[model samples]
Target: MMVSYHHKNSGQFEDICVADLDYAFTNVTLPDREGRWCVGVAEGKIVEIVEGDRLNAQHVWHLDGKLLTPGLVDAHTHIDKAFTAESLGDVFAQSGLASAIQAVRHLKSQFTIADIKQRATQALQWSIAAGTTAIRTNVEADAFVELRAVEGLLDVQRSLSDQIDIQLVAFPQEGWFAIPETLESGASTYVEQALQHGIKVIGGNVNQGLWSSNPEAQVDALFDLALRYNCDLDLHLDNWDSAEAFTLPYVAQKTIEHHYQGRVAVSHIASLIHVSDSQAQVAIELLKQAEISVTVLPTRIKLTRVAELLEAGLNVVCGTDNLRDPFIRYGDADLLKALFLLAQLTGYMANRDLERLWQTISNNAAKMLRLPYGINVGNLADLVVFDAYSIPEAILHQATRLAVFKSGKLVAGTMQDQVLSLHKPDFMSPRRWT
Candidate 1:
């Protein structure tokens, strides 16, 4: 059977014939399909996904019974400050969020355009090599770094457009109005400059204003900017340990007030884990009502009640928020590692739980970004093939990504070799070899 399909790549759509596929992946494991399946790609879009060994294409990739999934999406990250651990030195060794923020602010004061570009581009390459096809990174826009951070990331976004989709958020890490200079100098003006430089999202940390006279006003201000600029809102909400600092409900209320239901996302609401059950339930209900999504960075915090958030019917996703930065001293830009940490932190060890965790970094994150690729017919051909049997195994072992495809084009591939020798020293061996 032949079918005509519309192929879209890099926002350009064209009609193509499914029978003349440019490439096909055979003997791959697909969800909700029986036996080994085949995925046919033409003009950088998936044309046919059928249950069979159909490999009659110009190019064929034999999966050898490996797991194939939609390309990974990093819903939340900080690319501007990535890979700055060594430069920050031992000042952040035993620090919490507050001290880390201070150290990063100091570092940002010394940021040069070339330095930011080099570090951020390296991070993007590492992420792409690790099978991330899309990333929504928060670029800081404070009085220190100003618009240079946005410029650095914009360059990376343009350079990697074909290999990965990069969405930049004009993030005011210090705060919107809490910092006197930020407010006096027009913080919105800085964010506006970032938007003018091609940022598609606006980010703020409402918790920075919790001690202020009116924190709700700060949330309202960010929502107003989002509405005015016609960009999505991704806020850093309530990331502390005190339950009293939780402001997710307020963010949700503002989302409803602005009628910005699905366009809002709140990241690192770690305080929710410390709040009372009743309190958390109220916030979750409000989040569900507003349709605001959540992104959890399990490595950056002590704990996150991801299972509860998922059970509450909220669109919960996960990301590698920081990679060796002042905020988080460790990360390899690996989403699988983040997933493993999330499972261990939440004690979600069941098969279903692991599967859900996979979705957190893949499908759920994709939904938040509104990306146009998945394991389905008539979608963009962005996928990752892993050297694992099932989702549980993939999460447990953190298997190597055999291949990664962006718009049906091979971008990264890995082949590893290992050799182990079994030998004992004469002091410990019962029988020594002569």
Candidate 2:
């Protein structure tokens, strides 16, 4: 089928051809549909979605029997530190978080703009090939590294602007007030410089300043900067394994006090699992009232009560916090792998449970990041087509993507086969082939 529409860029009428839209999966939760469906694209936006057999257009793609869904969105990641496992040797084996922080600080000292850009671009390519269309990464900005991470990510963002959407958070891994240089130079100045360099979000580590004289003061200062700069907040709070480390309630209170509801997100609050059930409920209520979202990193921490958090009406999302860095030694820039691990850790085995888990990496993460693409008409044509029959089968097999589209244009996919063939005697035991 072919459809005619005006192209947004050329200011001219054009015809788009779509064929065999039958066997399409409209929604992840809905059952498959057999009726033919055609999607019309104009000016990089989905103009119309038709459910009929007779349609016409200039370009036609017959999916045959592929499963289509909204492209994956990674709500949280550390792209700057990706693929650095080989350099650390055995340091990560005996070191804790504190030691890891020190090691990262050392690594940052030697970071040049070219080096950072090369590594970050490599990570983005891996993500794009994995069917991820949008990513929100936290880049470090402190006295040691200054704006190196921010500048490098901005470069990568420009280079891949046509392939994927990248949102960078100017993160002060060291506390805003704990470091003497930051205090002397004024933390706002550092963050403002990062914002000027194209950072869209602001991030902080609440636990970094908790040991200082007054932790609330640091929190207030960070929130004030975010409000003043008109940037969203994504803070790392209460990451300890102790029950008494309760910064979530205070963060919630501050969110309401500053009128920053729905604009604030807290990550790695693993201590919520250690608190008593009643206390945890109270904290969850506070988070709900404040309209604050949560990002859980299952690989970095062991106790993340994802099931309970979801039941409390909180917008719980998942992220690959670190990849082959000091914080974590393993990650392949794949959010589906993260979702699978999260399901196993949280004991979500049922079909319905798996559907909900899928939402965390796709729709839920997209909403939190304020992206425009999804499985709907009149949205950006960013989507992924999988070579599977059902959502469950896709998750179970984790097969390679058939096609990845960004703004109605093909970006990444596997088109050629790479199989090796060798002959062997049939009498040989198959079990001993290895």
What lDDT score belongs to each candidate, Candidate 1 first? 0.79, 0.73
Tens-digit per-residue lDDT, 9-62, candidate 1: 545445556558888887777644546788888877788887767656887777
- How does each model score on TM-score? 0.89, 0.85
Best by the lDDT measure: 1
Worst 10 residues of 1 by lDDT: 415-424
* RMSD, candidate 2, Å: 6.3
lDDT of 2 at 52: 45
Q: Which whole-number lDDT from 0 to 100 does residue 280 have in model 2?
A: 87
